[model samples]
Structures are given as structure tokens and as C-alpha cells.
Target: MKSTHFLFLLGLLAACNSQPKDKEKETEAKAEQPASHEPTVNCYQYATATDTVRLTLVHVGDNINGMLIYQLKEKDRNVGSINGTMNGDILLADYTFKSEGTQSTRQVAFKKAGNAFIEGYGESAEVNGVEKFKNVDSIVFSSSMKLEEIPCK
Candidate 1:
């Protein structure tokens, strides 16, 4: 029985570790240096999702648009909002805000693409704090949500 249990645990670990080659970077947390100055540019943002994260997108006819909210955690927990265009399940947004004292911008790009599926990556910081968006860089969420359907805008 003990051997069976150990085998099961090992299998579980193996299963969890076995991810596709394209999504290796999604699981790691990202941190950027804090700044305390004004931003030279308006806002910066980026995301690399294809068709995962269905919940974050609202489709509208052939053209889809939605709002992306990035919560700044370190500075003042400030929330940054961006307007994104949706292609199938992928949504893209670029927004910025001030944290401690520095201004930073983040880009939202499509990670995956499909109907009702939305997958992508995005991170941002203000003058004092950093707020990393969840699901933006999750590898598993990218693959499964490719088949999920989201509401049409």
C-alpha cells in the first residue's frame, strides 16, 4: 500500500511537471525593479496569449474589445485599466499607472487563439508597487481554455 501511494505521488508530480515546450515560462512569477519617477511615455504593456482565458474577454461580432485590469500590489495596490482588441479568444491591452513615484507601462499580447478561448501574458508597475496579472502567464490555463466560450460583446 505504501509503495502504491508513493507511486501515485510520483505520478502526480510527473504529470504536473510535464508541460508543452511552448509554455515553459508561464508558471514563474515576474518581478520588476521599483521606480520613483515620472514616466517618459504614457503607458507600456504587452501580452502573448492566443486563445485561453475566456473569462477576461468579451467578443463582439468580427471585432472584439474589452478592458484589462492590472492591480498594482506593492505601491498602493492601485488598479490599472487597459483597452484591448479581441481576436477570437485573445485580448490585447496596454495601460499604465503611477506607484511609489515611478511610472511604468505593461503590454498585453495574445498567448493563444480560438473561440471562447483566451490566453495571454501581461505585467505592470507604478512608481512604487508592482501588480502581476494572474492567468496571464499560466501555461495550463492557456491550453484548456482554448475550447471555452466567452460572452459576446
Candidate 2:
């Protein structure tokens, strides 16, 4: 009778030890599952008939921060950086840049078109104490002045 009782106790111990293997498998399965999210960064470059522009933007929550380079051919160039918020596929920011040995600030807007950016152009106007383009319309950019996206560094 003592041996029967001992065998029963041994059987209970074996069953308990087997459960850990199943638990380990469950843990491994959870680890194998894909994460709920993946990080991403937006970058682009555009070439026009008279200029080349590049952008490298990092998304911070709903806002964006990055650099902007507008180089002209045989003319003055605007080189500076930008920081602003995005509305849908559009970005409106204040561009503080140097052109022809002078520094000035202006408000500019850009519209995303697939892998390209269509810069908005309009008559000069003052808004919020800064020089900005008013009467924005998509008709401003010609096909030769479109900016195309390039690989990020």
C-alpha cells in the first residue's frame, strides 16, 4: 500500500513537470507573433526646369521637421530648413533662407503628389507678419517645375 501511494505521488509530479513545456511553447508562440506597429520616415527630392529641391522629414506625432534646399540654375538659390505641421498631404511652413547674399523669411506650402511635391506659387502677400503666397491653386506648378522624390540618406 505504501508503494501504491508513492507511485501515485510520482505520477502527480510528472504531470506538473509536463505543464512547463506547454507554457514554454505558448511563450514562444507569443514571441513569434508580429508587432502591432512599424516605424517610418518620409524623404523626397525634386527637380525642376530651373531648380532642384530636396526634403528629409521626420514625423513627430502629427507634426514634421526637416531640411529644405531650393537650388536655382544660373540664379539665386534659397537654402534653409523648415518646421511645420501637415494637413493631409499638404505642408505649410515658414522658410527662412539666404538668397543672393541676403537672408529673408517667407511662408511656403507644398502639396504631395504620389512621389513628387508640387510647390505652391501665388502673388506675394503679407500674412501673419510674414511674406507668404496667397490665392493658392494647383495650377501654379507647371510640369517642368515638379519635384520628384529621391532616396533618403
Candidate 3:
């Protein structure tokens, strides 16, 4: 009777261990599957005689992730990554960048026009050490810098 009970306990332990192996295999199979939707990538650039700005945006539904580089004349170049959401024709994001060996974050806004994006500007105040527009609705989207769609390279 004691030997039968010991055998039964051993069988239960084996069953428990085998179940986890099956679950691990199932998890591995799911991990190997490709994503249902691929991210859409778009690049844009605005250039002139003295300054140039390049933007690359990747859209997955309404969420956006992108890289922005500003090479303005007589100014320290700011290279950064932006992650934000697209609300109607407006794109609002927080730009986190490293410039002059220091990292900083600031709020940026843009308006979509045809195949181009116009940078928005407005009164900004420092909030928690991050500069953000006082009122997003009051931002002016008439900046001369208009980033036009360009081929990714």
C-alpha cells in the first residue's frame, strides 16, 4: 500500500512537470509568429540655405514614433526621438534630445497639410523642468519650416 501511494505521488509530480513543458512550447510558438500589423514608416525633410530639419515617422494606428534632427545655422544641432499621438491633423509630442552633452525634453507640435507638416510655435513655459506650450489650441502653425514627405534612405 505504501509503495502504491509513493508511485501515485511520483506520477503526479511527473504530470505537473510535463504540463509546464507543454505550456512553454505553446508560448514559444506564439512568440515565433509575426505581428498581425506592420508599422508604416514615413520620412520628411525641410531644408533651406542656412538650416535643415529631417523627420522620420513610424505610424502604428494613431500612435507615432519618430526621429527628428535639426541642423540650424549658428545653433547647436538637436537630434532627438519623438513619441506621440495623432489627433485629427495635429501631431503633439514630447521631444527628448541630447544637445551640448546634456539631455532635455520639450513639447513640440505640428499640423499636417497636404503631404507636408508645418511646425507649430507658441508661448512656452517650463513645467517640471520641461518646456511645454501654454495652450495647445492657441499654437500658431504658420512656421516657415514645412517638412515635406521624402523617401527613406
lDDT of each: 0.43, 0.75, 0.95
By TM-score, rank the candidates, best first: 3, 2, 1
> In candidate 3, where is summed lDDT lowest over 10 consecutive residues?
34-43
In lDDT terms, which candidate is top? 3
Sliding window of 10 residues with minimal summed lDDT for model 1:
39-48
TM-score, cand. 2 vs. native:
0.63
lDDT of 1 by residue, 20-82 (tens): 432555533223444444422111232224211213433444333344433322425334445
**Candidate 2 residue-wise lDDT, 1-153, digit = tens:** 999999999999999999999999999999999765433567777665666778777666666677788776886777877777777777877777788888778877778888887777667777766787666454265445566777788
Clash number for every model? 40, 2, 0
Which residue pairs in candidate 3 collide?
none
Best by TM-score: 3
**Tens digit of lDDT per residue, candidate 3, span 22-74?**
99999999999977767999999999999999999999877899999999999
After best superposition, candidate 3 residue 108: deviation in angstroms? 0.3
The alpha-carbon lDDT assigned to residue 36 of candidate 1 equals: 42
Q: lDDT (0-100) at residue 138 of candidate 3? A: 96
Residue 105 CA displacement from its true place in model 1, Å:
1.7
Error of 1 at 141 (Å): 5.8
